[model samples]
Target: MAEVVEISDPGDPRLADYRDLRDVELRKHLEAEHGLFLAEGAKVVRRAVEAGHDARSFLMAPRWLDGLADVLERSDGPCFVLSEEMIEQVTGFHVHRGALASLRRQQLPPVDDVLAGARSVLVLEDIVDHTNVGAIFRSGAALGFDAVLLAPRCADPLYRRSIKVGMGAVFSTPWTRLPDWYDALPELSRRGFTTVALTLSEDSVPIEEAVAGVGRLALVLGSEGHGLSPRWEASADRRAIIPMAAGIDSLNVAAATAVACYAAARR
Candidate 1:
């Protein structure tokens, strides 16, 4: 049985970890120690607990706790019960789900290790929006990308908003950041990976043609407004695109990522 600590006074020091309405630094600390991030809502918390990560503690409403009794019993950590108002006061925001748990984030496999036996990988450069990051991850997980390579400027996929938008797909997908965006290209090439850039260049080939000749492949999608950087575009063995009949300028990065990821995986 998990210990249920009732928290009435918002000033209680035990609740310090959950304080603040929005503190990115505090969340980042969770990543430093165990790579943990808050999994909001009873459902996401339950899934995280079931996945066997060290669930440090849960700040939950009494009513919500009852529904999670089975999972709570299985948790090896403390459960703090708080009133709706107290939770909001501590978190500094309206927590709609009435329940949130802090779980350890596991270390991802190295880029080299991930690429060793991979058939397809998606490389995202300078994608900053958490929503788009989460959506891309959801699509990537469903579309069958072996792994995702995030550049230095990409949003943290494990952030609460991203995780929620991603529907917990971020938990299963493997991602590692490349220290230097350009430095990693040669490494990919050495592993027999054909780097394909999704761009709107005249010399770029159609999606079908590009995939036909490649074995191990890496598809690169740029940031939302800027698209791929000129240097990154030049890094590709060739460029590719999804044909549009109506002269659409381009797809949203999230939608484009899904199309590109699925196409690469299907090949």
Candidate 2:
């Protein structure tokens, strides 16, 4: 069983793992330096542990302890119990759901390993927003996509906000970053996945038609502001667009992924 240590000092060195979480750049640096990521809220914390991630440590208010008793029993890391006020002071924001765990980040599987036996996949390019990445992961998991492939520059899907927003779907989904972005689409084609990029080029076809009858499918999405790059738009096996009602031309990238993944699943 995990040892429970009661702490009152917000500046305690033991609380370093839970500090300044609202500062994105600082959290990124610290989490990468420590090779760890955080799981927030009771459900996300439970899911992280259940998915086989090892806890570096846990921070929670006294009220949240009993609810996570089963998780604590399985974890070897110490649980730092604190008042909700002190928890907010240490973490830099109010943790309403009350439980947080800093979990060791495991090595990423190679691209081929993530794609093995994957009939449907999501390919993301330069999506800088953590929320969109999280939402996309959730959509992919809910709709039964096999895996996710991120371009080298995409946002970290394992970030705390991403994990919370995705409701821990990243843990369940197999994903890895592409080593080479320039030839990514061609490589997917070589691996037997028809690369269908969601774009609005003049010749782009409907998403439903683009994915229809394809044996293996890779649904590609791009960034929020600019959409797909010219090179990527042209390199894909096919370009597709969700036909919109008269005024609106497109959806947000996250919303677009859900629709596209839904379409791909039906194929």
Candidate 3:
């Protein structure tokens, strides 16, 4: 069971993991240095723990305790009970979800291990928005994709914003960063997957046709601002586009991912 420690000081060194969450750069450094990631809300926190992550500590208001009592009972870390105002002051944002947990991060698995038996996969290249990454994971998980592969420059899927937006879908999804961004699609092809990239290239076909009858499919999405790079677009086995209304050329990366995942799920 977790030890309940009521803290009155917002500046306590023991609360380092819960500090300055609004500062993305600072949080990134602190989390990386400590080999940890945060899970926001009772649901995400519970999912992280259920996914076999080790809890470093927990922070919550007195009102949130009963709602997360089972989680506290299962965690061996300290639970710092504080006022709502103190939590906001410490974290630099109102923790609307009423609870937060810090969990130890595991070493990332290799691409081969993540793709061992995947029949349908989502491949992301330089999509750095935490919300988009989280939304993509949620869509892929909900739509039955086998795995996800990220480019080296993609945003951290384990970031607190991502986890919260995805409602902890990252915990259930199998994902890892590709070591070689330039050769990623080619490598997937070598492993017997048909690399279907979402792009606006003139030669691109409809998404349904591109994904149809594929034995093992990898759906590739690109950065929000530029879409797929010329190198990546040309290297894909097939290019596909989601036919949109006459005026709109494309959807937001996350919206596009959900639509694409839906089509791929039935393939």
Candidate 4:
């Protein structure tokens, strides 16, 4: 069972894990150094704990304790009870969901392990937005894709904003970073998955046609400003584009993932 400790100081060292969340680079380094990730909101925290992530600690106001009592009771870690203002001071945001947990990150399964028995998957290449990464995971999970593969430089799906935006789908979805960016699409092809690159290439076919009749498929999407890298685009087995109105060039990456995943689910 967890012990509840009341803290009045924002400078408390015990609260170190939850500090300065808005500082992206600093948080990344700190989280990496500590092997931890923060899950915000009551539901996301519950999901993270339920998904077998061990909690390092929990921070929340007194009012949130009852709502998360069952979870806290199961944890051996400390629960830091603080005033709302103190929490705001430590975390640098208004935690509307009223609970935040710093949980241990486990080793990600290998690419092959995530791909085993997966018929449909989404491949992301250097997508930098946490929201897009989370949204893509949610779409892929909801629309019947079996897994997700991220390029080495893609945003961390376990980032707090991503986790909140994804509604904890990142915890449920099977995913891992590709070990080799240059041969990622080729490697998928070697595993018998038809690699479909979502881009605006001249030879691109409609998304439906690109995925039609394929038993094993890997749908690849790229970063926000620039699309897929030349190596990835050129190496893909098929190029696909989601048709839009005459004037519009493309949809946002998250929107594109939803549309493509919906089409792939039907295929």
Error of 2 at 175 (Å): 0.7
lDDT of 4 by residue, 1-267 (tens): 779999989999999999999999999999999999999999999999989889999999999999999999999889999999999999998899879999999999999899999999999998999999999989999999999999999999999999999999999989998999999899899999999999999999999999999999999999999999999999999999999999976899999999999999999
Candidate 1 TM-score versus the reference: 0.87
Candidate 1 structure quality by residue, lDDT tens digits, 165-227: 888777776678887777666667777889888888888988878888578888888888888
Per-residue lDDT over 201-237 for candidate 3, one digit per residue giving the tens place of the 0 to 100 score? 9999989999999999999999999998898999999
TM-score against native, each model: 0.87, 0.98, 0.98, 0.98
lDDT values, one for every candidate: 0.81, 0.94, 0.93, 0.94
Summarize candidate 2's per-residue lDDT along 8-118 as a digit string, tens digits.
799999999999999999999999999999999999999999999999899999999999999999999999999999999999999989999999999999998999899
lDDT of 4: 0.94
- Return the lDDT, model 3, position 109: 91
The pairs that clash in candidate 4 are none
Clashes of 1: 2
Instruction: Show the colliding residue pairs in model 2.
Output: none
List where candidate 3 sits over 4 angstroms from the true fold: none
